[model samples]
Structures are given as C-alpha cells and as structure tokens.
Target: MGRSPCCEKAHTNKGAWTKEEDQRLVAYINAHGEGCWRSLPKAAGLLRCGKSCRLRWINYLRPDLKRGNFTEEEDALIIHLHALLGNKWSLIAGRLPGRTDNEIKNHWNTHIKRKLLSKGVDPITHRPIDATDCERSEEKKAPRCPDLNLELCMDLPIEMQQEPECSVVPSSTTFLLLDYCRTSLQMN
Candidate 1:
C-alpha cells in the first residue's frame, strides 16, 4: 500500500546534515543534475535516503534561496500578498523571488501574524487594528452629505464636520494602507 513509504525505515540515519554529506549531495547534483531523487543517493554515493537528499537540496542547498533577515520592503510585500492570498504560502513565495515557501510560511506565522495582531488588526480579515473585543468601527458614516453638495453644504460647517467623520473612517481600504501607515508613523 502507498508504495510502502517515501523514506526508508527509521533510526538508520536522519536529520541535521553534515558538511561532507552536504558537499557530496551538492557535487552530485551539480555534476549530474536532479531528475529522479530515488536514484540520486546511489548516484551520489551517499548513505542518506532519496527523500532526505531531495529535502536538503530544496530546503537548504538551492542557490536561488535568499538567506538572512527579510528586508522591510520584503516584509511589507509579504504582508500585502498574504492579505490578498491568505495562507497560500507557496503562492506568496512565488511573488517574492529567492524566498522559499517554508521560509515565507515561517515568516508569516512567526513575524507577520504577530505584527498584524500587535497593530490591532485581524491578520485573516485584514480588518482595523482594534482589539478582539472591539466591534467594527460602524458602517462608513453615510459619506457626509453624499457628494459634498457644495451649494447645499455651504450653509453647514462642512469642513469641520467632514474632518472628524473621516477621522473615524474604517481602515477597510487597500491592502497596502497598513504598511503605508506603519512606514509613515515610524518615520514621523
């Protein structure tokens, strides 16, 4: 059933790869190139299982991966993309070159999720950064005089009234607004 299993029986060898093993796997891939991972170990003369070799190459050895802390811009992009795409980490990773799905997923859960939450926004809904108990900021204030009706609005203090109403506006606008707000507030 299920072709037995992808990895070999346990306790044989696994986890925390070493330098020499890394070199052999890397060299083998470079020389012959990856096709069938099942055959890769035999060709590479490594004791590790084929699945292990594949995981190491994809998750670690790949040249395209971007190592180190994600820059501010990248983090901002990830947040925006995550908002639009949800927990689809692979798709998010696709948008940002050199970033891995696992890396992106980890960054999302560990960093971005908490950051969004700290700002009082629901990461999933991308709603206003308010506490969990806080109700929605009320339906869009009926758009203050609907079209500004300058002729009809002149009698009332439109500027004063409109300013406060707008200030109470919900942040359910663009995905980039929070990021922009974060940058502006931080810079100030």
Candidate 2:
C-alpha cells in the first residue's frame, strides 16, 4: 500500500505566500517557538501544509538567517568546506553560521561553480581543469610510505630464524632501519 500524505493537500493554500501568511507564520513561531511541524499549520491557523510552513520559516523567515550577497570570505569558506564535505549541503551549512543549506547549495550552483570554472578549477574535484589524466589518476592512487613495512610474513620470528652467513636484509627492511636510526638521531 502507498504511504499516507503529510496533510490535506486539497484544503491547503499553494503558490507564493501572502504577506499576511508570512506574518501569521512569524507570529505563531514567535509565540510557540519551533518544532511539532506536523501540527504547526493547524496550531498557527495557516492554510499551508506543515512541510510548507517549516520550509518557509527555515529558508526565508528565520531571524538568524543571513540574507544579501555572500562575502568574499564566505565564498572562500564555502569552497573549502565543499572540497572537504562534497554535496553534503546541510553539513556545509552547519560550518557557516546564519547560512541555510538551501541558500548555500543555490549559491554554489549559481555562483561559485562558475567562479571556479572561470579560474580554471574544477568545482567537483577542486583541482585544475587542465590537469592531465595521469595526474588525476595519481591522486586516486594511495601514497607510498617507503619507511613503513606492511608486508605480512608467516615465517619464524627474526630471533628464531637461522642467520645466513651473508646476513642480507631486504631493501624495505634496510630503508625502515635507516629511517628509525635517523629518527633516533634527530630525537637525541
């Protein structure tokens, strides 16, 4: 069976919210604060669905919301956050006080994306647009740590193993031993 609807869609008002509707929403929120969105419309005497009321309050009517054009610092911050967080708009919005997730997402698509492209940066990867395929592939590959030995050995322990006459050690082992010695010397 299909899931039940959130509200009586036939009865609720649609299209652009009137000024009175906005005022009513604001007054109701001011009186009772937020939450109980499923019943908010009934409580507020609004003809909007609970979802609509919640969205209007959050995306437009919220007092703490920062409206107007984004600042240069905000642009830089959004880019940095997007690089780390990707398309997680809500998480990105959390880092930026007063900015809503919807607002940030819209700005990213409408402005920041074009800005990045104009500067030769790929908005998705946050890398140079002209970067070679080899360079891109290199970024995808795991970095090698020459001094770290991750090989699993099923043989006997070094102490239990019979030493060869030549006592030759693997290159990786030699590199690790050298790194340890260097670290020890540096610490001392």
Best by TM-score: 2
Against the hidden true structure, what lDDT does model 2 obtain? 0.83
Give lDDT tens digits, candidate 1, residues 1-188: 55755545553367789999999999988988888898787778777788988989998998888899999999999989977888898999899998889999998889988988888777877766553323322334233233331111223253234322333233445334555555666776
Clashing pairs in 2: none
> Please, what are the lDDT tens digits per residue for candidate 2 over residues 65-184?
998999999999999999988999999999999999999999999999999999998898787766575564454343333444333335455334453122335688777776776676
Location of the lowest summed lDDT over 10 successive residues in candidate 2 = 158-167
Off by over 4 Å in 2: 1-3, 131-188
Per-candidate TM equals 0.67, 0.69
- Error of model 2, residue 178, in angstroms: 45
Off by over 4 Å in 1: 131-188
- Model 1: lDDT to the true structure: 0.74
